[model samples]
Target: MLDKVKELNEKFKTASPQEVLEYFLKTYKGKIALSSSFGAEDQVLTDMILKQDKSAKIFTLDTGRLPYETYSVMDNTNLKYNIKVDVYFPDAKEVETLYKEQGINGFYESIENRKRCCFVRKIAPLQRALQGLNIWITGLRASQSITREAMHLVEYDENNKVIKLNPLLLWSEEDVWDYIKTHKVPYNKLHDHGYPSIGCAPCTRAIKEGKDIRSGRWWWENPEHKECGLHKK
Candidate 1:
């Protein structure tokens, strides 16, 4: 797996995202799946996956705190693709306990509190959704963050014990939008409000121009440490 990752990276160093996706589809077959948050980049990738293989499984973490538009897209995607998007929800007991003790806004107090919220709402559900999958697809790009800057089109995810293929690793924000427009893909309407990255509703908002892609996400924290821990190694 490591040798194949190294081989594909050097071979597709200059290849477009479409090329990388083609390679992934050819390689993994049904053992692979795409995890999306239904943002523009995600919708772009989803369109590509459907074009390549309509049987490609797509899933998302609900987080139980998403915007109404995200929920609408989930339903819209089902009707558009004529396929079911498996929704992963948090552990019921954990969520119940968290809400009972700390209330909903506890995440604003500290990083620990935030991680706990993420664990229940996103991470735990993500882990459940990944079980039995040999490959995991995502829409992450290098330009999104310094952490993702060193990423490749294909890499092994030791955490999930699977091959993590980021087919759009090298795409820019403009590239994603262009693809979406060209394909007429369905997307959330919040992008026009300076929200380059979208997530659960309460914890996300838009940022000013010239800011980073993830600056609006978990913005109250030190910039270097604002990740939701889902994509963290």
Candidate 2:
């Protein structure tokens, strides 16, 4: 798998995101899937992928804490595309245990608590979403944060034991929005207000102008620790 991932990176190094999506969606078929968070980049990919193959596997993790706007976009995307995106949710028992161990909103107290909440809400559900899949597509961009800048267009996710494919790995923030507007893609309303990044409601917030794209997420933590353990290598 490592050798194959390296080969893919080299072969598609200069290819457009569409070309990469075309090849993999045909070659891998049901073995590949895109995991969207309903953010700008994800919305752009959702539009592109569905245009290529309407039956393409596109899924999202619905952490119970997501904002109402995110849900609204989710509904709008389904209505516009005429496709129902698969949704993965945290286990009820685990969520109950999480609440018992750390009261609601406990993630704001410390980095450890935040990560614990993230693990149950995002990571666990993500693992279920990735099951039986060979390629895990994401909306990750290199400029999003320090943690992701080092990632390649194609790399092996050792934790998930799957090939992680980042189609928009090189897209800029402007590029994402431009595609959204040009294609009339349905996007989260929060982006218009100021939230460049979106996650579970309590873990995300709006940022001031000139801040890093991911700064609004986990604002209390250092830049290096802002990840929710989903895309970490």
lDDT of 2 at 67: 95
Residue 88 of candidate 1: its Cα lDDT? Answer: 91
Mark the 10 consecutive residues where model 1 has the least summed lDDT: 16-25
Steric clashes per prediction = 0, 0
Report every candidate's CA lDDT: 0.86, 0.93
Which runs in model 1 stand beyond 4 Å of their true positions? Answer: none
Which residue pairs does candidate 2 place in steric collision? Answer: none
How well does candidate 1 score on lDDT at residue 186?
85
lDDT of 1: 0.86
Root-mean-square deviation (CA) per prediction: 1.4, 0.7
lDDT of 2 by residue, 75-181 (tens): 99999999999999999999999999989988888899999999999999999999999999899999999898898999999999999999999999999989999
Off by over 4 Å in 2: none
